[model samples]
Target: MTDQKKAKKKALKDSQLIVRIAGSERDRFVSLCDTLDTSAAREIRRFIRGFLKEHDDQLDGQ
Candidate 1:
């Protein structure tokens, strides 16, 4: 197998989230993830970072 195949296979293995997307949305998200070659953990971290940046101040007071 080549590098791209290896990377995708590793991604399938390493991802931990059981995201329950279905049909076209599932295909679209998987394709987008594949294009980015990004791990699920990394994606979640990025999401959290963005969320924090947008809402950390509100969170602190609560």
Candidate 2:
């Protein structure tokens, strides 16, 4: 496979996260994500990546 294809395969989402939140909050978040033309999972993944990048230095010290 090509390098780009290999990277794309490596980035596949093969796992899941189950978060339990209030129904109302979940509805609102999904609605906002729809209005923004994005997905809840996409936004959550972005947040997770940014959070890890922000805290990576702190983690390396431990």
Candidate 3:
């Protein structure tokens, strides 16, 4: 594969995070994602990236 193709195929995620929520809340969130034709992981990643970008300055001091 070309270098550009290899770069495109590389994994963007290299870490894991775990969160706990009430069982019913978890079920509802998963169901909502399914209804929207998306996965819970994908939604969480999207939210995290947006959140980080929004508050990047706060993180820069860490």
Ranking by TM-score: 3, 2, 1
TM-score of model 3 vs. true structure? 0.77
Residue 59 in model 2: shift from native, Å?
2.2
Across 1-62, the per-residue lDDT of candidate 1 in tens digits comes to 99999999898667455666668876776678879997655776689789999998899877
* Clash number for each model: 0, 0, 0
lDDT (tens digit, per residue) of candidate 2 on 1-62: 99999888788876789999999999999999999999999999999999999999989978
Per-residue lDDT tens digits of candidate 3, residues 1-62? 99887776575765689898999999999999999999999999999999999999998869
Summed over model 3, clashes come to 0
* Residue 3 displacement in candidate 2 (angstroms): 11
Sort by lDDT, best first: 2, 3, 1
| Candidate 2 accuracy as lDDT | 0.93
**Residue 27 shift from truth in candidate 3, angstroms:** 0.5
Clashing pairs in 1: none
